[model samples]
Target: MKINDILTLYDKILIGFVIILSLILLLIPFYYFGSPAEGEELILKVQQGDELIKTVAVADSYDEPIVFEVEGPIGIHTIEVNQGRVRVQEAPADDPLKICEKTGWVDREGPIIVCVPNSLSLWLESTNSDIDGMSW
Candidate 1:
């Protein structure tokens, strides 16, 4: 078949649209869309019952996991921090759900590790100093 007959007007327009869309999709990641910057300053905040227990800067390298035992409502609970990530290493026996321990390493900001049985929680947050408000 002749090229003209194979690619009609409508077919050409559709092909052009598809090519443009594919190119835009391919280049979207190259244009910064204001996603939270990776490897930025990440702060780990450990809280218990509305009180800020401890704050630590997440480190890239660690000899071993930093372990913390905090007394909670149920009993002693264990928290582990390693390589800019935090997770509940162990939860109290009273925690029937055991959801806290089940929640794996939390490396990004926004996710919170809460041990309901122990009234303990931890979260990673970005220090606003490096984060510009214009990132929208």
Candidate 2:
């Protein structure tokens, strides 16, 4: 083939190769880390005046602590649980400048309960089966 004809053929092949590479790159994330496999189970429990009240379970299995929010009569509460540990604290009662306390605990993935002046919450994390957040 002539030089010009060879060049045109090469251009088409290069373009096709680029398109395929781009598509493969886009799919790599979905294949590797897009959907994380189930992680360890985490459970949080809350108590009120010596009474067990609320419980929350993190569905996705993860090694890192997951932050969640709880609301009570006094104000909003922020909690973080990970590796069978629980951290509960008071948050701002109003909007704008809310802060969370640093009280935390650690235990097996079974029952973690907390009480905020009569208001209570609980978290239950399990690794035996697949549990969703709603199950909490």
Candidate achieving the largest lDDT: 1
List model 1 lDDT by residue over 1-136, tens digit each.
Answer: 7899778899999999999999999888556533347546778898999899988777642666788788877888788889768888888888899999999888766668888767788987786545343322
Report the lDDT tens digits of candidate 2 across residue range 6-106: 67877989989999999999999557433324665444556555565556665432566677776666666777666545666445455333312433454
Clashing pairs in 1: none
Worst 10 residues of 1 by lDDT: 127-136
How high is each candidate's TM-score?
0.65, 0.37
Q: Which lDDT value does model 1 have at 122?
A: 91
Global local distance difference test of model 2: 0.55
